[model samples]
Target: MKKTVHVVGAVIENDAQQILCAQRSPSMSLANLWEFPGGKIEAGETPQQALKREIMEELDCVIDVGDKVEDTTYEYENVIVRLETYKAKITEGAPIAKEHAQLIWKKRIELPALEWAAADIPAVEQLTK
Candidate 1:
């Protein structure tokens, strides 16, 4: 059986109405694809909690997590991913791409122009609507 990984993604929007997107590093599984910045849910953590921790680790910023955005389950070659995304705002510090190859803020309408990871596509659609 393929392992199912539970992960959380933060769809962080700034006051400018732009969304933050992260590019997967070359060493990462989905290299060069864009995604919301977040990581796997650890034991004893809620989805919100996981997102906060992940944003701090991956982007070096603190965020105020808000409503659930999208929930998707996607099956890849070796694993199944259950991705839970939430609306968020950076409460402190600017985002610095600590783990990802790059980070950029894009308008909702422009989001589709980038190639996104499969698991993140649903949330991207939801935000674009």
Candidate 2:
């Protein structure tokens, strides 16, 4: 039986209409791909809680989770991920690339220039619309 991982992602936008994207660490599974800042859902944690914790751990910032936006499921060669995505607003601390290689804030229209993760492509398409 294949194990499914429940992940949480945040579609965070700033006042300048730029969305936050993080480059996966070169040592990570999906290296160099741009993705919404998030991580796996831990045991006993809600999706929102996991999102907040993951963002803080990965970016060294605090964020307030907003409305639930969308959920998507994608299958990788080794495992399936059910990603629950949500809108989030920064409440404190400037974001730092603690886990990722780099970070960028991009206009929604310009997202095509960055190479995004295959699972994240659908979410980006939905956001661009």
Candidate 3:
């Protein structure tokens, strides 16, 4: 049976209205692929809390998780994942890429041009619309 992994992502926007995107590390499962920043929702944590913690841990910054953007359950080649993405804004320091290979800020129109993770495609389509 496939375990359903619950995760959260942030559609973080900067002052320039550019959305933040992250590239997976070479060692990660989806290496070199672009994704919204976030991680799994650990035990006893709400989706919002998990997103905040993930952004802080993965990007080394703080964020105010706003309204949810997309909630999707996708079946990857291996694991099945439920990804909930929220609109967010940085409330503290700038994001520093410590785990990801790189970060980029992009306009909504440019979102579809990048190679986004399959699970993130729904959110990207939502953003681009």
Candidate 4:
């Protein structure tokens, strides 16, 4: 089987020390789950380039790619994702969920209450800590 490598980006804002999160679209595979905004890395694109494109397409915003926080690999029923998470800062535009159902800003302590994608569990834990 051919494994698909997907690069995912996580956007974080220091709102007095909190992070921004978006709810996944109901029609999406990981429906109703809360996640840091990101998407798959397309062919011929670097992970950073892919992240910038995905954020622009999904949130209609510009972000400054910060330090790479973590790289994780996880498996789903249909595909495997090599999720590359980064600590991102929004340079311009407000975040609107063009692809997601809703958006939210949460403190580190509140992260566990929101439903997160299975692959994101570890990432979430790390972020909250």
Highest lDDT among the candidates is held by which one?
Answer: 1
Q: Per-residue alpha-carbon lDDT of model 1 for 1-129, expressed as tens digits? A: 999999999999999999999999999998999999999999999999999999999888999999999999999999999999999999999999999999999999999999999999999999988
Model 4 residue 8 lDDT score: 80
Per-candidate TM equals 0.99, 0.94, 0.98, 0.92
The predictions' CA RMSDs to the true structure, in order, are 0.5, 1.1, 0.6, 1.4
Tens-place lDDT digits, model 2, residues 31-124: 9999999999999999999999998898888899998777888898888888888889888888899989998999999887899887788778
Candidate 1 ranges beyond 4 A from true positions:
none
Badly placed stretches (over 4 Å) of model 3 are none
Give per-candidate clash totals.
0, 0, 0, 0
Estimate, for each residue in 55-94, the C-alpha lDDT of model 4 and write its tens digit.
8999898888887767888888888878888888888898
Best of the two (2, 3) by TM-score: 3
2 or 4, which is superior by lDDT?
A: 2
lDDT of 2 at 50: 95
lDDT of each: 0.96, 0.88, 0.95, 0.83
TM-score of 1: 0.99
